[model samples]
Every structure is written in structure tokens, then in C-alpha cells.
Target: MASSVSAAAKASAAFAHKKELAAAAPAPTQHRAGSGRRSKPCRVRAVASPARAPRAPSSTGSVKTAMTMTEKILARASERAGLEPGENVWVDVDVLMTHDVCGPGTIGIFKKEFGGDAKVWDREKVVIIPDHYIFTSDERANRNVDILRDFCMEQNIKYFYDIKDLSNFKANPDYKGVCHVALAQEGHCRPGEVLLGTDSHTCNAGAFGQFATGIGNTDAGFVLGTGKALLKVPPTIRFVLDGEMPPYLLAKDLILQIIGEISVSGATYKSMEFVGSTVESLNMEERMTLCNMVIEAGGKNGVVPADETTFKYLEGKTSVDYEPVYSDAQARFFSDYRFDVSKLEPVVAKPHSPDNRALARECKDVKIDRVYIGSCTGGKTEDFLAAAKVFLASGKKVKVPTFLVPATQKVWMDLYSLPVPGSGGKTCSQIFEEAGCDTPASPSCGACLGGPRDTYARMNEPMVCVSTTNRNFPGRMGHKEGQIYLASPYTAAASALTGYVTDPRDFLM
Candidate 1:
């Protein structure tokens, strides 16, 4: 960890003060989650039932639209466990993921709740990722890692990534990132399976057609306690997208638009089924980024119907034989909306809130000081490519102090080998080096969270910047004074090149 910047550092002095930015962040959105007029309470069963069955299996002998990804997984897992949807029956979990901060707490809870040795029903099924506090800026966190280390050693858990990568303790070797990305990359997530984790982003695994969701510490404790947790079949909502996304817009833009439309908690307890040609056009990486942020929209989870893109990504990786699942055409959906992406513009979410979004062009004049290009949400190969495209095209050195951290070591290795497209003499590393940007690639959330050596400095300085990360909440990316605009990698790269908040579209123009 570099001692150059402290976690308390504020954004640049030229930007808004912390108090003012914080004020803008908490401004209530028009469509606050859970604030909508209550429609009559529809039974979960009623919502799950289809109006009609498939006429017959298709040529591929697969059901494209039968039940939603979430519905199918819950139904199958229930059948295997002799339960039914909406029965609230506790069933076996196909996978369990934990991070350091909550990992130790879950262990203690598991011992107390189950009243036995620290024994998980299946050691291999459990993945322990020590990302959050792995850097251990505090003495208590260090102690917690010791406890987690001892527990993993005792249980013979195979997936454990420690803090040596980037100072964040959650940086484990076998575990690359937030348990969600690690599971997806490592083939731990499979179609039609039930997965639970301690982190909210665990819903990210839903991209692979799994019924993955997050739970509270107590809930996770119960899972480890009994190797199972009860789930009520969630209703499904569908987003039918159309048209091609503009150059500046990507999966992140689509999700931000949805979050703005629905507010943070719109989907509350409903599963999101992403259908439409636009969704099909998205690669697995983009789909995963979309599903990864569903929790932010208050969806139980999000899903993209398994397609060739999904199968190709998972075919060789999954140890378990892979069978794709798709929502039925006549599948019951609680609500649905169609999005036209062709006309969509780059969107930005004002801080202290993710749902506070508007067209990026509307805020183009906003000045920026720092540009961040990493996070579980934005730290993928595709994301890096998008950012690199902007940087290469600009031919401008990074005007501000910029940083690029890989979401995981694996991602770093995958992207690091590739050369910067326009830099005839430079690789990605060389490009960042020339621009005076710090390029640190390693495991886990290195600088996003207010972990030591990666935190914000200068408490109330007003600074604006683009970030490729989830959540622009109050004090989320560091100082409350800094104005953080959540954007895609392209936007971040553009800002890094110009030293201000410049939309990628402008460069296209």
C-alpha cells in the first residue's frame, strides 16, 4: 500500500465542499423505492404461475420462455429438496461466499446457531474471500483476519485470497474479487442453482442464470449453521430492451437509467428478467455488470436469458454440466417495461444516491480532479477495453492524477498483457506511466472503500470526477465533499484524458 494518499483525503479544492455535495446526494428522487402506491397484495404463487404453458419444446429442445431464471432455479431446488415456491422452505445452498469483514462474524454466528464445530456441510462449496479489511489498517481488522485464517485452515477451505495483493485483506489468491466476480470467473456459479453470500453484490451471479442473492449477517449465519436458508419464490419483472446502445452508453448506462426510473428499491422483492434484442447483443461481461447492480435497484436479483454468449463463457469453465435456462414467453411477469437504447445518452448518478441520475451531457461542464477505473462493477476486461479505447483515441496524457486498479489479479494479468491500441511504443502500463497515472493491479477493492492508504483526503474540498464503480453514496468513494459521478469505463477514461468530466460522446463527435 502506498502512503501517498490517506483515506481521509478530500477531492480537489476547486470542487464543491463536502457539505454541499452531501446535500445534493440526499435529495429525494421523484420515485423513491417502497414509496409507490401499494397495488393490492398479489400472492407470490399467482405471480409465479404462467398464463399458458409452452406449445412444445423448440428445435433445440430448450424452453426459451417458461419460467424466469429465478423462478426455475427456485422451483428446481425446491423439487430436489421436496418443497414448493412460496413455501419458505429451507433448502440446500449450491454455493456460499463470504468476505473478511463479515466472514469472521458469520463464523461466530454459525458456531452459536448450529452449536457444533466449525463444519460446513461441503467445504468445497464454501468460498472465503478476504477482501474488505484485508489490508488491516486497524488492529481489530488484523485480528479478524487471523481468526478467518485459522478457521479456513481448520476447515481446509480451498478458496482463500488474503491481503497481500493490494493491502485490502479481502484480496485472496483463489478468491479474486467480491465473491460475485470470483464465483463467475471460477465457474462456481451455474445455471438454475441457489447461491447466498454475505455481500449485496452477490446478486451478480444471477448473470449466469442462478438464483443468487445477498443476506444479512444473521441470515448468512443461519445458512452456515444449517447449510440452508428459507426463500420465498420472488415475483419476476421484465425489462425488454430495444435498439443499439450509443457509443457512450453501455451496460452501466442502461442500469443507471433503470435505477433512475425505478429508484433504488423499485424491485424490492421482485426478480429482474432482462429480455429483448439489446440484452441479447450484450456479451456475458456486460450482462454480469448489469445483474451485478440489481441489488442497487432493490431487485431480488436480475437475469439475462442464457444465450450463446453465456454458454460460450461458461462451457469449458463449469465443472458441472451446463444447461441453459430461459424465461417462458408466456411466463408470468409482475410488471414489464421496454427500453430503447439507441436514443439513450450517457447517464450520471449524483452522489449520496445512485438513483439521482440525468443525461451526462446535462452535466458536461462539471469539472473533475480524479478518475477511478476499477471496482467489482467496472473492473472487467470489457470495461478496461472501453476505457482504453477512449484513452488511446484521445492521444492526450492523463491531465489529472488518475488511478487504474484491476478488480482482480486475474483481470490484471488478462488486461496487462494487451498493449494500448494507439500507443505505438506503450503498453497499458506504459500509457498510465507516461500520463503519471498510478497503475496498481491486484486482488479486491483496493482503494474504493475507505480502507487504509486508499481513502480520500482533504475533508471538504469540492472536486468532481468520473468513476467506474457501483454506489456513489454519501462518503462512499471517500470524502463526502467530493462529487463523484458514477459512469462507465469510457467516461472515466475520457475524464482522465481531458482532466475534467467530458462525456465520451463528445470525443466521438
Candidate 2:
């Protein structure tokens, strides 16, 4: 019995000794594993939660008391309050937009990488719009649409706005006109959110004070699998446009002039924030037009802070709870420039590049073969009305074959009762119908992409085309031999009347 007790005492003492040694150990295995080799180890913590963390300092020496529009959106997306420009952060994506042009390729890569049966990160976050090549009779285009339709069906995504929604709105209650417009109008793009689209003009949604930009198919495929994207917070260039009223000039003229002055690469990879009395004077549709062409200027995005116009547009359209973000009064900017719109004149982008611009009246002698008055940049009801006033004032037939493609079905629907800008005797719908302008059945990207079976007005022969679309690059409108001139809808209508590039003011007087 004494021997048994002694053995038990020895075993208990050994265990107590082990406990002391463990308590006196230098550190845990994990804590000391890489500390001996390298001080900084790639240790990953738990997956990032949506709860915001403490804000880091801004790139500038100033401690940012308030965030800019871009900063707020990115910070919130990355689950942090403060973000410095040029720092790459992993951001949660609010919307992943894929159109017919890039949706198939994105889907192909997504399936190949994630496996066919692998589910998307967030099915409802994926938005598919088959607008780029839908009007074609080509089998491949149809197949592309079918792929998107099938994928959305399999994923049970509710945001896929397909061709049926183009005409039969009842078929899909979530129909929108264009991807950019649909994004905002349908409440997908909210302030303080991150929205990425497959097309460059995705910047258009930035008009609502959101962080919206374009990504290629590979990046989109990754976002499809994981609802996250690495973003380098972009520095913003603030443009202050304080000016008196100008009769002839519109938002298109202002943007054209800005592009001409900045060159296409001036704001490369940077955000262009439009501010001042002029931009504030614009309505939501006009602000969208201003932001849509930022891609042409090589900007990461173009934004206008949330204002009354923006607030009103989103009021009834969005039921999604969202916090509105704006640039602090003392927001830090990479560069700042001011322009007086009162001194600005009507402008047009010459052939080859969007930055190659000239005053509209200066290029009046330049002849045109066709006039296109539609695209995301110039398809709104306001654009149509602005153009209609010129046609009504002329009371003349269109000298050139003009094409009017409304930006969205809603814009098209509103056109039935559009008044001429000056409240002239006739409606815009009547003016276009009487002017021999060809109107497509539904609103779409149309000829913006110059896809196969090319929609309405494409260059069949080498000709000078004055268009209201955003870009004017070589072969942008289907013909390398064809030259394109970009202008406002008002300017385009005046040019269509004279069969040459003319200033709308000349006709207005």
C-alpha cells in the first residue's frame, strides 16, 4: 500500500512539473513559429467582417476630419472608415455588372475557375444586361443572350434584364433601359457603394455619388466567384465650374471642352469630380451624361456629389436603405481647376480621338453623311428635347439620315409627349417622325459597340458621321475608314439639318 501511494505521488508531481514548464514556455508554437526567421509573417486573420474599423490617415499629411465622396464609398466598401489614396484595399462589391459583350467571357472564366456547380458568392449581386449585341440576327449573338439567360436562370438571379424585358416589360418587372441607367434607376447603384461593370462607361453611375468603374472579363470572373475586388483608392481631381448662364452650351459642350483641355491621359486612373454651379444646375439625366464620358478621358470614374436632383431621382426608385455620401467641404484633391461655363462654346470631338475637339461653329464646314442621336451619353429625354428644338426651329427636313435611339425604354416612353425645348408648337416625337429619322423598336446600347449585324446607323461606306455617342476612336463605329465627330444632341440635330457640323446656337438664333 505504501509503494502504491508513492507511485501515485510521483505521477502527480510529474504532471505538476509539466504544468509549470508549460506556463514558463517562451510563447505559443504559432506565435514563435516564424518570429525566429522573419518578423513579418503573412498571417491571415478571420475573414473580413462588414463592420468598419478605425480609419487610417489620408495620403496627405492632413488628418482627414471628413472623407471625400470617393473615400467614403471605398472605405465603407472595405469595411474601414478612412482610406488613403493610392493604397490598395480589398473591397466588398455591391454590384457586379456583366453585359452580353463581356458576360459570356466572364461566365466562361468563372465556370472554368470556380467549377460549373460552384455557387456564386452572391447570386443577387450579379446583374446581367444583354444590351450590346441583342438587336442582331446573328446566331452567335443570340447564343450569347441565351447563355446569360441560362446562367441567370440557373443562378436564380433576379437582376438579369434580358431582351424580353426590352419590349415586354411585364415579362420581367425589373427591366431597365441601359446597364448604367438601369443600375441607378433600378436602385442597384447607391451612394457609398462599390459598383463594377464590364464596360468602361460604368462610370456613368458615379453621378449618384458611388464608386463605379469598369473591369475586364478576368477581373469580373473573379468578382463573380468572390464578391470582392482589390481597389487602389483613386485620387480625385476636382473641377469647379462657376459661371454665368450660357445659352448655346450644354453639359456635352462643357465635358468636351474639359476633355480637350485635359487630354485623354491627363486624368488617367484618377477620379474626376464635377462640382460648381454649372454641374449643380444640371438635372439627373444631364449629370449622368457628364459622368458617362469620363472613360473617354481615361478617368477611373466621374462623380457628382449627391444633390437635390440626385435625391429626387432616387427617392421613389430605390427602396434599398442606403447612406448618402458627399465630399467634405475641405476634401483633399490631387488637382483643382476652375472653368467659367459662360465663356464656353459648343464643342465637338473630331475624328480618331475623343480628346481631339474643336468648337462646333469652327467645324461647320465639315460635312457629315449620317447623324446618330442616341447612346448612353445622348439618349435621355432631355437630350431628345434639346435636339427636337433645333429641328422644330428649322421646320426643315433632316439633310442627313438621322437615327434616334433612346437610351432606355422609359426615355422612349416619355418621348411620346416631349415638348420642343422652347415649348415650340410640336412634340419631339413628332419632329423626329416628320424629319425622316429612324427610331429603333427598343432602347439598347445599339451601335455603341459596333457589333455584328450592327444596329441602326453604322458606316457601310466611308463617311463623316457626327454622333452623340461617347467615344470617337478609330473603328469605334464599325468602319476604320469612317470618321466620327462627337457632339451634343442639340449640336447633332443642327448638323443633321445642315448636313454638316454646325452650332445649335446658329440655328437657335
Candidate 3:
């Protein structure tokens, strides 16, 4: 453990030295011609100095303070030497993302406050993605996208992922579905940066070791007029998850367990930092799943410190240089909790609340009418792979109707292109077809947000559904009386096969 901590300190120092050298060098003059836009120069900020040993004395004869990853990132973004919880600071925004659901309202506020002729603080910093309300006949929903497109064109926003053809998603090459997934896929989520989005799930990017959180339309408008936001530094709750994860469990199950332990309002306005061996073993997608539902616990943000796994995932995704930060060995926390993941089992959130948790095996008698496997939380490539693994193991058709919606166009393509690890070269598409599940729909936030009356696979009647979505509240998926059970992809697939809330262990073991 001591050796590992020393290695981390050395790595952080090396990154700081590299950043300093890069700052002193001349800027490159290359343009992203493929996207018809010029790449922006890396903006240098005050880099946090390498942390000292726990309780070590400083040159001034005072004990140096230890900072958490969240605090260090905020300090750099706010251009401060150090910061503590509850301190209000003005942080420079690295990325400001807005989607169709909140874009129109944010734009309205921007125009009303900054004037119609006033230009945005930075065109390239703003990302407008039209994910929700697409693939629907709702005139108002269609109008929302038009409003976003007009605004992007007027502002010359370079990162607008627009979808024009509602009939077929393939016709729109620039379209990327689901803003959170699209943000990470398109290289907007860099380590040690500050990202504020109009949607609550923006915290998903925290998996990349960044400070990401949601903002209201008014806050977004302020960010549009000025590339800065005044935010309070949040006290962080440390969660240490040790031991190897069980085969029947996934990141979704782990997060559900945490939320269940602490309730929905437990982490209100607090940063939730996940660490330990279990987290380090998770892939980038699994780490994303862990951070995606922090908002469900009313957390201000969720973060996993960047490591080689994070750097590897960002290698081809982003061209921008970034320096990752880590929490000091003695970093202070508001509270701490520890869990042994190997001893845990599959769990789910019952209807009416996200924190209403129960063991999947205990709820085996609960009959489900349908199953859904989609949304930013559970619709990534790994998610579908996990589901297909269950179906492949069971070797049986689903008793209930199963719906699959990939979160993004890239994820959709991956479903068809990538092969399941041990399925005799069979892909997720083939497995879904063999299981008699519905054909994978075009990538979007389909049925997750209950967009319209005609939404594909939406529950219009009072039906019980076992879903991989984050929320299980009444009417979260469709009808107010409809019951939704939030579970892991593995559990959802197993339940679909039996038409009951079944535990994945029944098949995996």
C-alpha cells in the first residue's frame, strides 16, 4: 500500500511537469478539417502541486493540507491554491452541454438575459445534443430540435449533434443519441475539468475523473453568457468497495446497494467518491454505470479517480491533453462507508422510489409484464453484452416481451459489430434475435423518458416491468400506475426469461 501511494505521488508529479512544459511551448496550428472546425488551444490553469505525505510538515513549518480528487479539481478550475468544503468559488467551465429537453428553455433564458444579438462566451465550449423527444410525431418535441438547431447555427456551436431524419436515424450521420453517452464518446469529458449540463445525469462523466454535475436553465444561461459558474464546493462522502465483484453482479447492482444503504436523500449536495479494488477492476463502461445514478441519491456529483483504465479509454476518444488528479492519502471526508463486493448479491429498487431496494431472489414471486434494457445508465456496449450473456447461458426464449434500445448510434453499431466473448462468434444482435426479443430500435432515449403517447415500447397501461433504467418511481417509464423494477442488466434479462423478478444466479451458477 505504501509503495502504491508513492507511485501515485510520482505519477502526479510527472503529469504536473509535463503540463508545465506543454504550457511553455508554442501552440500547434492544426485544424480538425474532418469536422470543418479548428481545434482550440489547450488552456493552461494553475496546476495543483504534488500532495505531501499524510500529515507531513511544509516548508513553512505548518502541516500541509491533504486534498481529495474533487477538491483538487475544483481548486484548479477556480484558480485557487486550496479550497475547502462550503467555500463558494467561481469555476471556469470546460464544457457546457444542453440537450433538447432543456435546450429550448436554456436558450430562451440566454436570449432573455444576454440579448438576442449577444454572442455566447465561447461557441466551441457549448455542446447541443438532440436525443430526447426524437423519433416521435409530437409537433412540440420536433419544434424543440428546430429551436436548438437554429441556436447552434446562429452561435456557430461546433459540437452540436443534430438529428434531422426522424424516419430513420441512419440518415443523420452527425446525430449521436443520449447526451451523457455522446459527451463521453465525442471527447468532451476530460479529467480534472468542470462540466455542467442541463440534464441531471451529467454526473455520468464523473467516471472520467472530472467534476461534472447538473445545472438548471438559469444556471446554464449564465454559463452561456460567461464561461464561468459560481458553485459551492461540496463535502465528499468516501465509499471504499473492496474484494472482487461476483459474476452475477454488475455496476448497477453495486450502485443500487449503495443507494439502498444511504437512501435517496442521503448524499444531497455532497460529492460521492468511489474507490478501492472493486472500482479499479471495473471497465470504463462499468465505471460509468457506477457514477450515472449519483443523482438518484441526490448527490451533487460522483467521481472515480483516473488511472491507466481511464487514460486508455480516452486515448482515441480525445485529442486534448489532460492531467489527472488523485486524492491525497490523508484526504478528509464528511463520512466513510466500506463494502465487500464479493459478499453482495443482485439487488433491485422496487416501485415508487429508487431507494426502495430488495434482493432479487427475495422478489422472485413478483410477476413482470415486460422488460426494458436501455437508457444511459444501462444501454452501453458492455450492458448489452452482459444481457446477451444471460440469454446465451439460459438457452431459452423470453416469456415476457423484451425491448432493447442502445444509448447511442455508436453503441447501436457496436451491438451488431462486436461479438460476445464466449458465444461461438455470435454477436448481441444474433443472440437477441435467437431469444425472440424485439429488434433493436434506432438509438435515442426511447421509452426511457416516456416522451409521447406513441413512444416505442412505452408502457401505456398499468403493467409491471423489470427494467435496467435508473429510476423505478411511479410513471417514470409510462403509465402512472405502471410498476417498474430497476435492476441490473443480468437480473433484467433473467427476469425476462421467466416473466418474474428472478435472480441472475439461477442461470449463471
Query: Which candidate should be chosen as best, given lDDT against the real structure?
Result: 3
RMSD of each: 11.7, 18.9, 8.9
lDDT of model 1 at position 493:
80
Q: Weakest 10 consecutive residues, lDDT, candidate 3?
A: 1-10
What stretches of model 2 exceed 4 Å from their correct place? 1-66, 164-175, 421-425
Model 2 C-alpha RMSD vs. true structure (Å) is 18.9
Candidate 1 segments whose C-alpha is farther than 4 A from its true place: 1-66, 80-87, 116-118, 163-175, 420-426, 453-462
Residue-level lDDT tens digits of model 3 in 280-347:
89998999999999988888999998767777777678877676666655567776666788888899
Ten residues in sequence with the least summed lDDT for candidate 1: 20-29
Tell me the whole-model lDDT of each prediction, alpha carbons only. 0.68, 0.76, 0.85
Q: How close is candidate 1 to the true structure, as a TM-score?
A: 0.82
Per-residue lDDT over 266-371 for candidate 2, one digit per residue giving the tens place of the 0 to 100 score: 6677888887788878888888888998887778998887656766677667666565566654456766666777877899999888889798989989989999
For all predicted structures, in order, the TM-scores are 0.82, 0.85, 0.90
Candidate 1 lDDT, 1-509, residue by residue in tens: 11111211233221221211021111111111121122321212212333333355455454433455577677666653122224465557888888877888898888887775758777887888776655435777677777777888888887665554444323444556555666788878876678899888888888877788988888888876567888877767667777877777889988988777767876777788777778878888898889988888887788876655665677567666444445544455656565777877788887767878877777777778888887789887778878777766766788877777677667776666776656674566665666567765554565565465433321134567578888877666666677788888887887777776777876755
* Residue ranges of candidate 3 with Cα displaced over 4 Å: 1-64
Candidate ranking under TM-score, highest first, comes to: 3, 2, 1
